[model samples]
Target: MLKAAGMLGAEMSTTRVLLALLLTSAGLRRSSQEEIAEQQDSSLITSLLETYSAVQMPNNGSMPLRVSILISVSNVMDVDILQYTISSVLMLNQSWYDYRLRWNETQYPHHSITVPLETVWTPSFSIREAHTVETKDLSPKVKLHSSGWVQHILGLRVDSNCNFELFRYPEDDTDCQLTFSSLLDTELAFEVSYVNEIENVKHEYLVTTLDARTSHGPGPPSFSLTLHLQHTPSKTVLSLIVPSFAVLIADVFGFMLPILGNERISYKVTLLLGYLVFHSSLVNGLPGSSSCNPLLIHLFLSILTLLFISMIETIFVTRIASEDLPSWMSRILWTHYTPGNQNTGDDGKRIEAEEDRVTEPRSAQEMEQRRQKLAAGLDRGFTIVYVSFLLLFYAGFAGTWFLMECHTEARPRPRPGF
Candidate 1:
């Protein structure tokens, strides 16, 4: 029984030793595999770099390199109406194939590798209308796939020039474009794709449409991003048009006061002063452009002139009713009231007496009645003329506004593509 127990103990010890040996062998194999992978990765990287040249173009000079670009607009920073410029943030994803950077999948454990952007050849792009452009990389490194594809991402803050159409002003809509072109002399084919990922950007102008288009010419291949912006006229209408109309209505009703009193003249003068203030504010608030000025400016000026003319007419009528005119002026005004020469005989005396009575120095009541009648006739005629002018002016303005609206609606929009 002692011999059998010793034998069982020895058997247990051998089994334990074998298990330890197996574990050691498995660990060694795993460590070797890891080392091998590391060596292979290093070798692949070394080989790729040794053969690569960043200054050289990706493909042979015989054919143009085809590059695909994706543009994503992140935000619209500002739209300057005075400067006619637009500032925005854009993310560009540019991808191309480089045979020099390719590696066989079986030879390397990594299906993709990250390399510094400076170590790879990239196309240089510039904007045609941009006055200022700042570029930043999404990552310092670019991704290189085993199949020879490369992707680079960058962000740009661009301040580009835009032509603004302000004929309708507060009711205006404008189209702005950012054109990007390659600076390299080597022939290149560009495929542009666009997506708007804008978020949390608010302004008086809202982006109504976004489009991308490509153009090929003798100079270079170009891509354009078009942004259609619509102005929100609510603010302008409330601030400008409403107040202008109110002032105009008040001026029109000023005629209700009797023209013979200082109250009417003073009231008209006050309205004129108030309108001048409004006009000054309007001119100062609006952006000025030599090419195109808003129709609202002209409308304001016309209203101002009408108000001044109304005030002048009021003053003239007041003078006519309140003050006596000179003899020569009265004779010119009432031609039939002139006195004839005195006669020497009875018949002449009778004629002279009749002339004196007809052209007599009238009493206060009679003279006042005649003056009031003349002033009332002049005032009535002016009121008719003023009302007619206002009607014609407003009708013309409405017609112009309607035609502009129709024209804008009928204009064809550009189609987006590669």
Candidate 2:
């Protein structure tokens, strides 16, 4: 019986030892987990930046740093044709990798960390054609991932110079560029991306296409964002083209009035004056460029010239009808009344009488009738010529305006050095 009690006591001692070992191991594990959590919360950032140098380029200047650029255009604020500038609201996202900033997630317990931009190295860049740049962020920061990736986001209101092809004017589609170039001497390989979040509304221009490309030349790398913008021509058409067409139609129909009365001449003079007002407005509405001017300007000027010529023709025809025919014209009209064959005798007398009958009218009523017939014939001939000229002129203008490519080839501007 004593031997059995001894074996039970030995088994109980073994059970106590096993339970004590398990409790000790559980406590140790809890302590270790708490220590790790504390390190992550407090020391992770300090450890990362303890040896980091913000000014040094990654990879010790051996290889070109690869930077991924994403430009999200939220709104096109304004496109100034006269000043040759475009203003935009843009969100710029730039990302790169730095091996020095990397850390083991198992130890750090952080997927990513937000750090002040002054804490790490970042790519420096500038807009080549920027006239004004405004930053929206009061305090800028960067996001560093545990996997060595760094992301920087910026909000900007930029007014950049744009070379616009205004040959087609209101119906034109122009290409404008926003060129971003690296200011750092350290070489950079760029991967460019573009996102156009513009909504189609009543804006002056619609961004029809977006293209992103990189330039790797003798100098630093540059990334260009080309926006293909189509103009909204409704307002121009209503204001300029419609009014010009109406004036031209009115001038064409003005020939229907009687040329014998003063009404037609006065009417044409009034139309010409009104057209001058419209022409002045047209000139003011379209902004001119040194490279190429809008064809619409020339078209309006040509219309003005035609209107002036038509008025002059009306005055000349009216004067011809009001007065008697000149001697030279009467000779032409009456071939038999030649003065070269006349002698001082009955033949001369008869020739003089024939000249009187040809040059002068018999009665006031007959004279008026003759004037009316001559004026009507001349006016009819002019009407035919004027209408025919207008038809041909408009046809040629339409063909040239629609079919011909008039825009100047865009040349690359010199990249400004930082």
Candidate 3:
């Protein structure tokens, strides 16, 4: 009877094991791919979006957003577009904090999640007076910090339709503004402040932040974040100023070439032509402004005029040297020094003077002598005049350049009036 009972117990255990295996296989088949996928979707949506985090405002009060910028200006385009990388961090009350508090969770399920804010309770910000902003980096990075501030890092290529003042061009220093203000808020809704930001900039452009000023008026109320950009004039001097001076000097020396042939004329003409070519390049490089005339423009125009006059004078004087002296030129040029005519009462002297008045309008040999005298006088006189003019012109040119530099530097300095 004991053996029979033990055999029945073993059979019962075997039957139970087979029944468990059958149940496990049936459960695996019932859990299909579509069912698993539906479960995941429902779980994520309920946890992240629909239940807690995606609301306009979890708390009732307005959130204060403080902004700071780390800009690395790579390329400033011709269209007044600043192609730059701006590492911008906006500090505010993190939205995730409210969600966590509501759910009573110790940790967020995911490390980070991106929330796209639309035109909702939170106000938007924009660069004041900016024409447009081109977003180069695809999407802004969103992260929640332990300190309870949401951090956002973004890269933007900003196109600001700025009006530039190039009064001191090439050696110009400018304060171009990259003002950030609330698009909808104005001063009433948000207090905008710039946290003195980090800058990784190019050597050619000395970028520094200027004093903040409010843009107060009827329009969308804004504030300015001025970027004081000082162009390092080192490259400008090398490419334009030094070359310009050098060309002017070469032109001046061209006048010294023996004016016997078209060699001098041809050389000077070519030199002038070269400078004209350089001028075109210069105009292209010059910064644009509403004001038409710049200091450099005035200076260059003066130089061009002087060169043209110098060339014309070269031709005129050389022509005089080659041709016969006109009666007017002969009369003015020949100054035979004489003691005031003494009343010697000598009849022979009186007769010789009378005969001089009656003589035919000088012989060819005598005319030739007068022409040579005129040419020699011209060489001496022109040398003095030309040298004096050149000295004055160059003095003015250099003085103007230095004066412009001084004005530009002084304008940016911390003065009481400013």
Stretches of candidate 1 exceeding 4 Å from the true structure = 1-45, 136-139, 199-201, 324-364, 404-418
Residue 144 error, candidate 2, Å: 1.3
For model 3, give the 10-residue run with minimal summed lDDT: 409-418
Query: How badly does each model clash, as a count of residue pairs?
Result: 0, 0, 0
Could you give the candidate ranking by TM-score, starting with the highest?
A: 2, 1, 3
What stretches of model 2 exceed 4 Å from their correct place?
Answer: 1-42, 323-346, 350-365, 409-418
How high is the CA lDDT of each candidate model?
0.81, 0.83, 0.54
Clashing pairs in 1: none
Of candidates 3 and 2, the better by TM-score: 2
lDDT comparing candidate 1 with the true structure: 0.81
- What's model 1's lDDT at 24? 100
Residue pairs in clash, model 3: none
Per-candidate TM-scores read: 0.80, 0.80, 0.62
Model 3 TM-score on a 0 to 1 scale: 0.62
Q: What lDDT is reached at residue 340 by model 2?
A: 32
**Per-residue alpha-carbon lDDT of model 3 for 330-351, expressed as tens digits?**
4544433122233356775786
lDDT of 1 by residue, 44-78 (tens): 88889887889888865687888899999888868
